[model samples]
Every structure is written in structure tokens, then in C-alpha cells.
Target: MISHAKIPFVVFETEPENAQRARDWNFGIHWSVPLLQDLMPPELFAKLASTRVDPHRPVQPSETLRFLNGATGIEIGAAFIPHLYRVQRSKLRALLAEGIPIQYDKAISTISYTEDGSTVAAHFEDGTTVSGTILIGADGTRSKVRNLLLGEEKAALDRLEYAALWVQAKYTAEQVKYLRSGHPLFLACCHPLGYFGWLGTHSAPDQDVPEEWVMNCYISYKEPIAEQEKCKKWPNEGNLGEVKALAELCFAEPFKSAFGWLGDEQEVWYSPLTQWDPSLPEHQWDNHSGRVTLAGDAAHPMTYQRGQGANFAIKDSLELVNHIGSFLDSETKGRKEAVRVYEQETKERAGEEVRLSYQNTEMVHVWEKVLQSPIMKHGLNPTS
Candidate 1:
């Protein structure tokens, strides 16, 4: 919207340019298609086709499979869904930021307001400052903007009992085909031992070259009380053996084979799952008289179980644009009310999404409750 309006604004990125590309792939689901379609040009929206996990095997909407005991337990249906694109996030961002002004590697040190209080300023660690009429904190979970608004103690994310590990690996043509025996794009399963496994195609060769293809597999589970301390070492230790042992023990067929592709030297990214409950008093803030506010994961971080995280972020941006547009209109004089309205709507809407995602996260690891989980029952549809 800012780009369309020719509004002058600059972005501060904590990472260097192209750094996000390393994160590889993510899903763009049905819920945000209409908004994105409107936001993006038809030609650009059409480029999502190039990012498909299996372009040669294109279908209207590919179903995500869930398994139990080596058998398919549930298939997340595609009915009523318009687009389910596997997005290369960096590619999408590069397309959207075609002419936008962005300064990479600018990390925020502090946030403050002008003496007159009509403007907000962000102080960067590099000894530079940028001020604007309004500041939107679109940063991720550990957002410095949020910490400045709510204070360190209150802004801390609530760590869940679960742990997740992701391993990115390359495969030969034969191995790639065998690994995708379950699904060409993504599939997940829960074992009776209380572990959940997800395998997905991160990148595929257009020319069908074996060595050019890449995939990622991850396992998440509730950590046992006795081993919680040891799990912290998994990330820095750069180990895949333990993860391999667990997958071999709990999963079957393609899932096990995917894990087997993990070389002992391959890097593993590990984290203890965490979330922020937006409804909590400590998590709420004054919004600094409408000059400052939060958006996306910076406001309400939740588990990826329900896949609403990015959708809500997009929703927040749309709502913010709507309210800010109203405020900017000459017919209205509610300058501060614009941010207040955005906050109210985001608080209620994203708060509910955070709750539902947390609930789904808890249920997904437990085999018996997995089918009854909200995601399994409703697919990726939003919960009001």
C-alpha cells in the first residue's frame, strides 16, 4: 500500500541483503491469497508458480498428508482453497520490494520520541537514527522495538516445553525421488512415542538435476523433564546423530529415509519452542500515543502448527494501512485514533489466532489428540 500510494518510508533490516534466502522455503496458503492478489500485480502474483515445489506436477491445490504407523491417517483437503504455493520467501520479498527503500544491516539500539511527541525515532546500534510520524515494529519475535515498548522482562517470549530441530540436506535424483515418496512438497506425522516429523521440499531443480535439489526435515516433540537440560546443547553441538536415532525409533518409511539422508556433519538448527500470549497484561503496551505499535510476530508470536503466523502478519499490515489511510484523509482528524484502532483490531484478531495456534501446537505432538486438533479438522482455515 505504501508503495502504491507513493508514500515515502524506509525500512531497517537487521540482516544483510539476501540473508533471508538461507531460510529457504515456506508455504503461502489460501487465507491470504485475496489480499496478496490485490496487493501484488497480476504478473508478480503469477510468479508464485515458479516457486512451486513440483511445478511439473502442478495441481489445483496439493493436499498435505498426515501419517501414523507408516499409513496415511489424514489428508488435509484442498476444497474451497484457492492457492497453496510453496514460496521461496526471499523471492517473494524481492518481488514485493522492487522499488521500496530499505537499508539492510541496521539494527535498532533504542526507540524514542521527538520532544514535541509528534514523531517517533529509532536509534540504531551503528550510531544512526531515523524518525517518522509513526513507527511500525514489523520485526520478528525478539523485536527490539517491542522490548523498548514493553521492557525486557515483559517482552520476553514464553518458552514452551517443546523442542524443534531442522536439518537441510541435498540429495541425488534417486534419493530425491525416494524421499518424496510420501509427498512432493510437504508431509507430517505424529508417532505414538509423542514425536512429530515434518519433511518438505526446500528447493528443486527445474532441469531435474539431482545435485541441485534440496530438502529439509524436522522433528519436534515435548522434551522429557529429565533431558530438557541436555537438549539445549543440541543446537550448538551441531549434532544429527541423536536426531537420527529418534527418527529411526519413532518414524517409518519415507520419514526414516529422509532422516537417513542427514549426514553426521550436516548442520542442525535447534530451538526450544516459544510463544507470546498477546492477551497478557505484560504483553500489552500503550503504543506510545499512536506513534509506536507492533505488528506480525513482534506483537503476537505463536507456533507454526496452524500456519496462521504469516497470514495474521499480512492481516495486520492491511488493517494498519486501512486505519492510517483513514487518519490521513482530510475528512477525519483522529490522528492518534488511527493507531489505536489498529491496535484494538490486531489485539483481538491476532490474540485469538495466537491462542488457537498454541492449542494446536499442544495437541499435534500427542498422537491420539492429533486428529482432533484444530488444524487437522479445519485444514489451514482461519479461526475467528
Candidate 2:
């Protein structure tokens, strides 16, 4: 949007670009592909194919999603669009951040408005400040900008009573073939034992070279967080044993076989699902008369069950660009009105998504209710 508008803007990134972290989850870009293709250059959009987990079936009408333990599998796909494209989060970010005016290591501290309230300034923890006509909190789930706008209590993430443990590891040729028996890119299974199993290729460096492929597998179950407990805890670095034990108990056949390939030296990570609803009354905050607002997950964070988080975030961004574009082109419409309209639409659209995803999250964990979930019925499309 900045490049198209020819507007001056700077992005403050909380972490350095090269900072090492675990391989993030893959995004299933289905309904938003047209929006992304329109926003990005043809060459850039073409480059995304290299990041595909399964280059073989990049654009199919339907995906064969497998299930385990006698539970029925689903062939879910969008009617208007083909099957979703699965791309690594890292690769997608690199593609999107190609040439933006981004400043790394600039963590947000607070937001202050101009005395006349025509502009907003963001103060960073690095003892620096930047002022702009508008401040957009595009940060992730635990956004600092959200805190300053809505206060600490309102900005807190709404935790769900579910959790997952993930492990990313390389596999032998035979192991890769065994895991791929279900699907090439990703597989989702709901067990009759009240657990969810997910296995996917994290990075397939070379499709011909199976040894270079890294697979990510995780088992999710109902792990209700106590009211006082803040986070889920387990052996972080070298705890493949614990995760594998849980997987053995939860999965069957191919899913279990995939986790059995994990070596003891591998790393394990735990995540307690959480989300934020911008539509909620308590989440309302002073937008500094439209000079200050949020975009992306900072505005609405939803559970990943329906794979709508990134889709909605992208939708929020593109719609916001359209709103701002209209505001810039119109002489009569106030900027406040532009931002207000954008936010209202986002709250209504993304807010319902958050609620549906939360419900999907709950339903997927229970075997008896899994098939009746929205995802099983309508696939990974947006609810609202």
C-alpha cells in the first residue's frame, strides 16, 4: 500500500530480521490468493511457489485430508477457489518484507497523540520516537501497541483451554515416505480418543532428496489452563521423550510412525492457544480520532483451527488500504471516519472469525463433535 500510494512510512520491528527461531507454522492461503496476487508483483507472487510444502499439488480443487483411528477424513476445498497453497511462514514473511521501510529492534513502548490530536507518535523502548499521521499496530498476538491503546488488562490475550506440543525434525528417506502416505503437504486427524494429530512437511529443501526434508508433527489435546496459570510448561530443549510418549498414546499408524522418527536430541515446544476479539466492548479504546488504530493480528487474533488467522489479517490490511485510499482521495470525508469504517468492518468480519475459530478449536478436540465442526462442513474458509 505504501509503495502504491507513494506515501512515506516506516515500520518498527520488535526483533531483528536474522534472529533465529523455530520454524513457524505454515499458512494455507486459499480465499486470499487473489488479494495477494493483486497486491504483489507477478514475479514476487510466482516466487511463492518455491516455498510450497508440496509443489506437486499447489493448486488443486480439493485436498485429501486424512483422519486416524477410524474417524472419517474430509476432502475440503473452496468452491470458487482451488485447494489452499501451503507456504512456510518464514518464506512468506521474507517474500512480503522484500522492500518495505522497516526498522528492526524498535520495540514499541507507548503511544502519544499531538496536543491538537491531528497526529500520533510512537515511543519505543530503545529510547527513540517516530511520529506519523497515523499509527498502525501490525504487530502480532501480544502486541505492545495494543496495550497502550486498550490498557494492559484489556489487551491481555484470551487464553483457550487447549494446548499443543510441536517437534520439527529431519527424517530418513523411508520415514519421509511413510509420513507422506497420508498427504504431501499437511494432514489433520481427529482421533476417537479426544485428541488431534497434525503432521506436515516443514521444509522440503528438495523434492527429489527426501533426506533434506524437515517434518513438523504435533499432538493437541484438551489441556485446560487453570485460572491462575499463565502458560504451558514442559522440557523445552531436549524432551522428545515426553512428546513422543504423548503422541503414541494419541495417534495411530502413520501419525504415530511419523513421531517415532523423532530423535531424543530434538527440541520440543509447547503452546497454549489464545486469541483477542477487537469487537468486544471491553476491547474498545480511544483511536485518537482515527490517527491511531490497529491492523492484522493486533486488531483480531483468532485460533488457527480454521486457518483463517493469516487470511483475515491479510484481508484487514487490504481493506484498510482501500479505506485509507478513499480517505486520501476524498476531500469531504474525515480521516476519523475512514479509520472508523475500516475498524468497524474489521470487528464485524474478523470478530466473528475469532468466535468461530474458537468454537472450531473446542470442537476439534472432542471426537464425537469433530465431524460437525464448521471446518469439516465448509473447509478452511472464513465464517463471516
Candidate 3:
């Protein structure tokens, strides 16, 4: 889970009462309270391992707020967890509990779309079928569902010309001690080449021993590599030569050591970072077609620079559910009315988000332009 630790600094500088007032007026009354933190660093992980607190214990907003104030330099009015593994796991469990049939091996072959409207049917590779009132394409960048809906072999997901390599390995006891000696729960080291890297430890809820902890090394760079060639040229693609070469060029000394320690010849996973074109009309869907609808990445797949993909997905779901509820409440209204309303609102809101997300991508990759903006300086600088 990615947590923003910059909100408290903004709130503190502005005075907590003023911050609460601003939030109450613009974000509704429920957002008035100061954010707090509950997770207590490595100690919390220790307790979870010892059964001091339930592994399923709900994470409080305060813990995150505190972390933000003390850690990041940015001042933010809000802090959000972009991807909550626990929430996803809980939802999966709930689906299983409700007796919904789950298919693990079967991949979706195609999405059948009506010639005139929004109702979509999915055909699995296993020859099974499922229909939905609304088709939400939460599927990632290479969304087969999107291709089927548009009746095209390719949808307009633009490659940002960047790649990310993520690795996981066990840290020795001494190394672990060194890492946590003075640092808090989270730490990120910025690379000189515009690449950002993070190393952290997340406790496995199911594990019983501290030595069995998992350490993560996430690194990203703006270098384009063919998907097929990536696998063959790197550790998985060929040998450790290419991986080490790229790693050495993108990372500094300690990180290079860390990368080498993690794996010398093992297959390293590589993902090409891509973004959607905000100016392209293909990204926009008209509700004029009636029942056919789209949500999440299907609607707007932006760059991950802002870390807003999953958060926006959840926001889309919430808005969709609300619109659905209102449509159902109106006895005389047709489903098309609901779809139209939802599309209109979603398009306007999501379009802006997509545009901003793309702009953020540019800001990260081209910091010179981003830093020149007045608003960016204010919100991005905690001491401002």
C-alpha cells in the first residue's frame, strides 16, 4: 500500500482549525477531523507477529497522517492509501463466501458488445459466459475487454516509454537492523537519473517468524525496451549481464549492491509503463448509446506517476453505485437514463483526472517544467 505522508505538514502549517474548516466546506462534513497514525513502525509488525493486535485490524487514518508530517516534504490536505492489499483480499474472501463461482485458470477470450448499446457479454477461453448490466473494464493497460468493446484489435493506450523492475528478497538480520535503526516505517531514495526507487518491508500476516519477512526493491526508469526482448535480454531473457548493466546505469552504489544481492541470474519481472492520451477522442465514450458503459482503466488509463489509478477506480465504482441506486429509485426511469447520467458525470470528472495524471507524469519525468508552476510549488512544498 502506498501512503502519502505529506498531509500533516500542510495542515500543521495552515493551523489545524483552518484546515478542518476548508475540508468541511469543500469535502463535506465527515472530513473535518485531523488525520492521525496508528501503525507504530517495526514494533507494530512485531506485535502482529506475536498476536498483540489482530492482523485484520483496521488501519486508522491518524497513523498515516503522522507519518506524512514527519517524513515527506510535501504538504497535503489529504493522505490516501492507493492500493490496499487487505481490502482486496477481504473482497475476494467475501465473493467466495457468497458462493460466487471463481475461475482461476480461464482467461477472458472476448467481450461481446451490442451493436447499438451498453450491455456487454464476456466469453471465457473455457467457453463460459457471463453478462453484466454495466461493463466495467478494470483490466489493466493491455485490456482485451477494451479492444472487444471498441471492435478493434488495439485500443489507444500510449506507452510512456518507461519500464519498472521490481524484486523481492530476504534481508539479513544485520542488514534489517541497519535499515530500521533510525528510519521510520517508510523511506524512498531518489535517483539522480530521474528514476525513483523505494525499499521497504511489509509484514506477512500469515508468517510466524520475523526472519521470514519480505523486503521489496522497486525501481523505475524512462527507458524503452521491447516486451519480448526484455525477457530474453535480462536475467530471464539471457543472463545477469543485461540486468546488471541497466541497473548500474539507472541506480547508484548502494542500490546497485542491493540489486545484485537480490538476484544475479534469476528472472526479473519487467513492466512497461504506459499512459493514455488525454487529447484523443477515442478515450471518451458517449452515453448516447444507452446501456453500454465503461469504468476504471477502460475509461481513463493514466500514468502511475500520481499513484491515482486504484484510487480513481474506487472513486469510479462509488460514483457508479450511487448513480445506479438513484436510477433504481426512480420507478419510471429507464436504465438508459442512469447510464447517460453516469457517463456524463464520469466523463467530465475522469477526463480532468486523466489530464492531470498525464501532466503529473510529465512533471516527474520533466521536473524543470513542473517546478516552474506556482500552484505546484505551494502544494508540493511543506514549508511554503
Candidate 4:
């Protein structure tokens, strides 16, 4: 399972009644399963929970405030309180002690399906080939296997018309103390043009540097030609001068200070927002007409707006594995039935997520309509 160790858990706080209302409105009609709740010690829960805004308090509408206007009025989205922990890679090694063969550094070149249904082969960029009974394309968004399977029908990625610039920097304890006095770690400010920005800290327990915070600045605007041009460069090797300049221009003073802390221009990471359509069909290949499938972002690359990419990927892997395990144990069904069952189940579940993710994209980028939405205004509570 993909673990969420590095990214802080973000919990938004609102009145319980309002929260329930939102739940009913947004998910009630669509979901039949009970929503998962975090069960942690009270102290840990309190520590993890940081208020984005006091929904009970009055808010002065300002041109710069960032919020998703609710059905009744404005609702705030908050970040997680910074409680950092250094990820011990050793723990990961211990978990993988079962001697599961791990592949590292070698990039997959091509995945080929034999005309008959028996073997699937993967050719690596290093001129090595590996054959396996089952082939899963865990490779991300622009999946090589997926393209090969679908031939000309591969789905195209839709740009979300936003960009995020991220950097990690050191801050003095004194500076952090001063900043935290007024603005909490989870706080964010909204702009009139539907743009929002946030700042948060990551500090490990019993650690010396509580001041060091990873700064993530997100700006929403129509995708400019220049930003699109930059995305063409290989990630981490692209020219980010123009993007950095634009971030400095759009962000406020606090964010400006945060940006200034980045000493090297090359260190900043720029990501152009893009989402995959959920309606796209899953890719399938044959073993001389046998059984192989694609899963995860290789099957469905969604916007990070809902933070469901990793979650859904893990879910896909688990579901697929369970199906395969069951099929292996069965004597009658055989490989073809197992493959069919796995594909059918995966599409049903992952497809729904893809659709929901696409809807969230519409809600965020299509702000004018979303602003007046009944769900946004009243949440789940209907006005009397």
C-alpha cells in the first residue's frame, strides 16, 4: 500500500451541524457506504485537527479572502497542523523483508501482449526483458502499456488551468513563533478571482528545527501559454524562471517572504494542473489473447483536488490482488474468468472515483456556477 508519510493530514473544521449538512448534500445521494472516520486518541486527534476558520465567527468579506462560498455563505478550507516526523527508510526495509523482488531505477520500455493468451512480456530501457503470468501497469499518467493496449483510443489529459509551485526552506524558530502567533499552520487566504494560497510547517517530534516549513503556493488562473510551454520540459529539468516570476507577482507578502527563503532558483518545483477523464475505458492486452490489465493512474489519472489519487491507486491494487488470489484458488473459473471478473470490478469502482474527481474539477474551475450552487450554499442543510 502507498503510505502517506510526507504530506501532512489536512482536516477542515466547521460547525458539526454544517459539516453533517455538507456530508448529506455532497455524498448522501451518491454514496451508500458509511464514510470512514479517523479513530485516534483524543490528544492525537486534537493535535492533528487544526481549524481553518471559526465558522461560528463572523467573516468580513474581502476581495483577497479565499473560500468556497457555501450554500448559506462562506466555508473555509484549512491545512493540517505541522507535526513532522522523519520517515525512517529502515522501517520500510523491514516491512519488505519477505524478499519480494524489488525493481529500482530501471524504467519500463514496452509491454507486449502475445497473440495467444499465455505470457505477457515487459522490455526495459536497459535491454532486459521479463515475462510474467499477470501484467499490471502501475506506471503513471502517460502509461506506455496503456497506449500500446488501446492503440489509437488512448485518452487525453484535460488541463485544469491552474499551477502549483512548491519549495522547502528553513525558518528561524523566532520567525515561526511570530508567524504562528497570528496565523495558524492550517490557515489560508482567498482571493476574489477564485485563487487561494496556503502556508504550513513540517516539524518532527523531539527535533531541533521546528521552524523549517515546506511552502506550497497554488495560484488559479487560465493556463497561460508560457506555463504550458514549461510543462513540455522534463519534470525537475525545466526552466522555471517565468513561473517563479509569476508566483512572486500574484502571491501576497507572507507568501513572498516564503518564496524568498528558497536560495536556489532551480530548487523550486512547478506542476501544471491536469486531470484525466474518468469516463475513459481501461486498457487491456492479451496473452496470445490471454489476460493482462492496467490499473492506477495508468488506468485513471485524476486531479489532486480531492487527494484521492494515491488512495484510489492503493484501493485498485488491493481489489485487483484480491480478485487474482481468489481466482488462483478456484479450480473451475480458470484464468479468463478471473481476468474478466477483476476487470469488471475494477472498472465499476475506479470509474465512480474518476467521475467524482472530474466533478470536483468542474466545481473548482467552473467557479461562477459553483458559487451559486445549492450544495455549496446550504451544504446539506436546506434553508427553512
* Top model number, TM-score: 2
lDDT of 3 by residue, 1-384 (tens): 013211110000112221222111000101211110121223332232122111334444322211111123232223233212222222222322232233444457766667655465767777877666555555655666566666553465766666666655556655655543333233344343456554444443433443455455556656655663555355454434554565566654445554655555444566566665423566554443454566777777876544455445555655666566666567987677777777777677666766676565555444344343222433211121
lDDT of 4 at 144: 67
Off by over 4 Å in 3: 1-106, 110-120, 180-185, 206-208, 224-233, 237-257, 277-279, 285-288, 366-384
Question: lDDT (CA) for every model shown?
Answer: 0.75, 0.77, 0.47, 0.47
By lDDT, is 1 or 3 better? 1
Over the stretch 1-384, how does candidate 4's per-residue lDDT look in tens digits? 122212112111112211222111000100111111122223432322121111122222211222432221244443221121112222222332223335554566677666665777877777877776777766678766666666645454556666655454456776555434334332344444455444443322223455543323344444665766766564653434543564466555555455544455445555677765534434334423335577778777876444456445545655665556666666876666766776666666666666665455446555465554333343322122
Q: What ranking emerges by TM-score with the best candidate at the front?
A: 2, 1, 3, 4
Query: Clash totals for all models, in order?
Result: 0, 0, 10, 21
lDDT of 4: 0.47
Instruction: Kindly report which residue stretches of model 1 are placed more than 4 angstroms away from their true locations once superposed.
Output: 2-6, 20-22, 53-59, 70-81, 224-227, 235-238
- Score residue 122 of candidate 3 by CA lDDT: 64
How many backbone clashes can be found in candidate 1? 0
Model 1's lDDT to the true fold?
0.75
- Compared with the true structure, model 2 gives a TM-score of 0.92
Give lDDT: candidate 4, residue 268. Answer: 50
Give TM per candidate.
0.91, 0.92, 0.64, 0.62
Q: What are the runs in model 4 whose C-alpha is more than 4 Å off?
A: 1-99, 114-116, 152-156, 177-189, 202-206, 211-213, 224-227, 230-257, 260-266, 281-290, 365-384
Task: Give the 10-residue window scoring lowest on summed lDDT in candidate 2.
Answer: 72-81
Task: In model 3, state the lDDT of residue 161.
Answer: 65
Write one digit per residue (lDDT tens) for candidate 2, span 205-304.
7778888888988877776688215434444543467667766665566777777767767777777788999899999878889998888889888888
In candidate 2, stretches whose alpha carbon ends up further than 4 angstroms from where it belongs are 1-4, 55-62, 70-83, 227-231, 237-239
